[model samples]
Target: MKQKRFGIDIDGTVTCPTSLIPFINKDFSLNITLDDIKKYDLSEALDIPAERCQDWFNEREPDIYWSSPLAEGAKDVLLKWKEQFQLFFISARRSHLLDLTQKWFETKDILYDRIELIGSHDKIKAAKQHKVDIFFEDKHDNAVSIHEELRIPVLLFNTPYNQDPVPSGVIRVDNWAQAEQWVKAWIDSESFIQQ
Candidate 1:
């Protein structure tokens, strides 16, 4: 069984999708559940003015990043994957947040081969540069692009924000458990094909 390189996204992929809801509810004094988040931008989904959202984000982004809870089963599955795959995290978070990201990874005891905070959701270049055999993503567009451009498999963690359609190579998974199973299947089929 040869090792593979996997490109993963942060935010809703590795962190719980509802991680920001509590903070938003606290800040806005509005009770909104994870179900209310239909778009990737909180401003758009919450109906908050973009400038206000930007200001709020600028003020609280660090705290938000620091306090984000890991996705269910993410640590366990990732720890297992670490032994057989090179984990490369490609996040849209600003490059300056590397320290916070690394600290969070340490706290969660998740190891990775590399982490890229590209300050944008466009991840095709990074995925290509890393030569990832597969990608795990939460963004609908990014997932579609990575798969279509790279001609590789992508496990898209399902979220309300990314409910758009995807191509054949993009698989929608609800949790890390499904992601693990899908990856295992891909690897098994890949091995069979290679032989």
Candidate 2:
């Protein structure tokens, strides 16, 4: 089988979706559970002004990223797929944090083919530039846009915030285990189609 280039997102996809909840609750002094986060932008759910939210995020971004716990099964499955797939991490994080990102990966002992931090959630261009055949994402709009713009399948990790309608190409995965199974199925189906 040919090696496939895969696009993966960080933050809520690689890291547990609720990883930042504790920080938010303590910092804002508001008791909100992960279930209360219905929007990817916390400002919308928290009823905080966008500017204030952005300012707070800017100040606490590094700490949030550094302290996030990995999503269940993310490391093991990614490790197993490392040799078979070109694993590219494409995040909305600022590129300046490349050192931190790399350090975290090193600390986790994970391997990757490439890591791109574009400082924006709009990743269709980056995905196209990388020529990725498949994408793993957690943002609803990002997943939809990437799937529509690139015409490639996207495995959107299911989270409370991203429970939106998706087209046929956008597959929802509850965890990395389901992600692995979906990728295997997709590859098998694609192979059959090509033949």
Relative to the true structure, how large is the alpha-carbon lDDT of every model? 0.92, 0.92
lDDT of 1 by residue, 19-118 (tens): 8888899999998898889998889999999999999988988999899999999999999999988999999999999999999999999999999999
Task: Assess candidate 1 and give its TM-score to the true structure.
Answer: 0.97
After the best TM-score superposition of candidate 1, give how far the Cα of residue 1 lies from its true spot, in angstroms.
6.2
Model 2 — TM-score against the truth?
0.97
Model 1 residue runs over 4 Å out of place are none
RMSD of 1: 1.0
Give the per-residue lDDT of model 2 (tens digit) for 137-167. Answer: 9999999999999999999998889998999
**TM-score, per-candidate, Cα-based:** 0.97, 0.97
| Regions more than 4 Å wrong, model 2 | none
**Cα distance off (Å), candidate 2, residue 3:** 1.3
